[model samples]
Target: MKVLVGADIGGTKLALRTTTPDGTVRVDVEIPSTGWEAAPVDQAARWLLDRVRPVLPEDDEIAALGVGAQGCDTQEHCAHLAAAFEALGVSAAVVNDAALLVPAAGLTDGIGVIAGTGSIAVGACAEGTVLFAGGWGWVLGDEGSAPAIVREAAKAALAAHDKRRPDDGLLSELLAHYGVADAPALARAVNDTPTPATWGPAAPAVFRAAASGSASALAVIDDAATHLTALVSRLRARGAVGETVVAAGSVVLGQPLLAARLRERLGSAHPDLTLRLLDVPPVAGAVALARARYGLAGVA
Candidate 1:
């Protein structure tokens, strides 16, 4: 069997797995990322190599290495990553984390929506026609991401405080979650960090509050779905993909309302376009792509 290693690196977490052709993580390690801007690519590569080395078989040569990282898609970034891998004593192919989602979804090509710390959407055709919408990161775009929802939820709370709206479940629960008993403290904390991924943990809180019939929180969830669907719609309209879209990432998979809203929105844009949920993890998708590349699967 061909030996391959797959790594999924993000801003906050890093996941590394060693597997054979069938996508089993015989040995896996999850670690904290040193931050996107803080750690250089070479440093990250070394860190991953350290974790993967122990799991590798002494007699097995690494046939190929596939990396799924948050910002590895761009040419400049990928070059640095490739150089980093070279420094770490591994020749590897690196790609955008979203690109790996295609095979992870068990589809050769389709639209992928990743709703995690931040949000982004990707569309691909069977022939390798890839397109992207959103994914501007937490600062610029990243609508429908967890941070986006938290940011909006915070805004709504402040607005209610200013307008003398009821200090109901939405505002009250938000303050408690953030460890602030008042609107001013919440505002200060939000402004202090102000990063999109920073608010990721709050995405669940938004869902919880919404589930309890909080109008404001529900509105936030609806808005997130609307934004995400808009991206999917644009990709479909541009002929970047076919009729089916696959939803990936924690927010899309973990939150039922977000998924329902995405389906609803997609139904309006392309009634024939079916929205499916990806049950497998992205690391599995990375192995799927690796299998395809090594001539182990049907792609050959």
Candidate 2:
């Protein structure tokens, strides 16, 4: 039998799904994306193939494959990955992982926002040219993402300390979370090793502080929401064709406050756009794209 394969490759993990043309799921599994690298296309292709080969049924052949990759920021990058896959004897379509959200929500055209370890917004114009905003990674941007929230929260807390302002609980929350006794130590803890693994885990402390009445934490969250909203607006300004915004990823999906704030801001800024949380795993979108692109079936 011929099978369609799809994969959603994020910074933390890769989710793979395989289904027959009729949408019967055959294999669904997730694995760490540890060795995966998007650049040097051949290496990316090999990394994907290594994982995929074991999960697929021995008797089945892959008719088409769709991939949503985290580091595939540009069309050229995606095309390079696709060519690499083709060279390795697999027919594949590759896109930025954020692009999976719209199709995962079962929409043909819309905007996708991901706020997990990192954040990015993706959409396409009338000509199907993909557009992007934000997604500068944790250090510089990725404003609604978990690591970014923690990064900003730390900065806020440190600023308050330097000014001799009263602790709004944000500083204490961060200090406790990082197991540091004072503000300077907290700065050292956060600044010494600035990675998603280190910073993302502390994001919940920011939200907790906010819930416990920390104005600084609330302001950080509000700013994050605003930045997320701006990503969609930027996409629209660049002629992205979509009336809906589909959001996914751990930060947005797991944090009700952030989700609510984003909804409120998006409503105020783009009243015409509708916000929807993706209920399905994003690999479903890759599967749908594979089916559609291969003339097997429309999105499911």
Number of the top candidate by TM-score?
2
| CA lDDT of every candidate | 0.74, 0.93
Clashing pairs in 2: none
What is the clash count for each candidate, in the order shown?
1, 0
lDDT of model 2 at position 79? 94
Q: What is the TM-score of each candidate against the true structure?
A: 0.87, 0.97
Q: Which one wins on lDDT? A: 2
Model 2 regions more than 4 Å off: none
Candidate 2 lDDT over 1-300, as tens digits, reads: 899999999989999999998889999999999977898899999999899889898998888999999999999899999999999988999999999888888888999999998999999999999999988888889999999999899899999999999999999999999999999899899889878999999999999999999999999999999999999999999999989999999999999999999999999999999999988999999998789768876534
